[model samples]
Target: MIVLDFVGVGLFAATGALSASRKQLDIIGFVFLAAVAGVGGGTIRDLILGVGIFWVLEPVYIVVCGGTAAVIYFTAHLLESRYRWLLWLDAVALAAYCVFGAYKGLLVTGSPVVAVVVGTLTGTLGGILRDALANEPSILLRREIYVTAALLGALAFVLSDAIGLPQPFSACAGFVVAIVIRGSALALGLPLPTYRSRPGREHGAIR
Candidate 1:
């Protein structure tokens, strides 16, 4: 769990730094965005669960986020496509965070439904915040399977645990489910169907 938390924080922080890079922001911006993207979701989860925030307790997570930002700031220009890197890194982080968040939720509440919701939020909220702050297109606005992937991954973990699976195995199962779904969406352009109003419908007209 500790390892997953660190990995997810670092990767998400890197994505935040990449967003800063795209915006041509300064080092301070990189650090700020990275820290927010790294800890935003988990902070919300801990707050909702009435637990001590993870970073507030350890502090290493913030250090990791800052370090990740510094690294990306120095090397991001070398990449031919920073957006591609951000997408893939965010996908992996989302996978890991979903499992970590769900595990934490289960520990606190022992409720599968809460676990799933918290896991999904943990996986996606940081990126959502990052994009909003960066003035980029929100991932939630994309017609892809981003949030759905996280939700299904969390559900997978809870279901696997309920079926008496080992903790590590269940975590792996959730991570795999999330990454596979997200990766496929990235690679194959899989998208969710969007709602469309009927052509003959008038705006704001009641049925």
Candidate 2:
């Protein structure tokens, strides 16, 4: 349901704002980052689907994002590194949001393949926008296993569904697959497989 999507969105907002806080950004910066990270995916989905933009159509979405932002503004430091802080939570949020977006694409648009793409877009665009807006490089530029893994997991869900998996079971499996893939990446320091750099470009910085 959309409520679950909003919950995942809220968690993401909190984590983004928390990250901004760790960087010593101002309260307004944290809130703005939270909103960007929260709404970015939904906006992409709406735009792709020609659905008149979800947040514009629903004030609940904005309210949920804003509320999470405010909470994070005050409680950011509550999540210390001792708890593994934001990373683990963000991973979980990513998994849930992926499933949520895929569900929307399937239900709203009735296309499993498109659903997978939408899921990946929904789960990742926010993080990309967040990083770029903060004057940091996009996560897509790193040799890190990130949104591509999400897309793969989402597509796997579509495959499972095509093979007759029930909606609930498929969603659960997809969510777990994403989390495992991402968690393994984090735990094992999995880097994205890279090719040789172009003729004029430098490489091996992270290597």
lDDT of 2: 0.76
In model 2, the clashing pairs are: none
> Residue-wise lDDT of candidate 2 within 97-121, one digit each (tens)?
8877887787788888899999898
Find the candidate with the highest TM-score and give its number.
1
Model 1 root mean square deviation, Cα atoms: 2.6
Q: In candidate 1, which residue pairs clash?
A: none
TM-score of 2: 0.84
lDDT of 1 by residue, 164-205 (tens): 999989999999999999999999989977576645557678
What is the C-alpha local distance difference test score of each model?
A: 0.94, 0.76
Poorly placed runs, candidate 1 (over 4 Å):
198-207
TM-score of decoy 1: 0.94
Tell how far residue 47 is off in model 1, in angstroms: 0.6
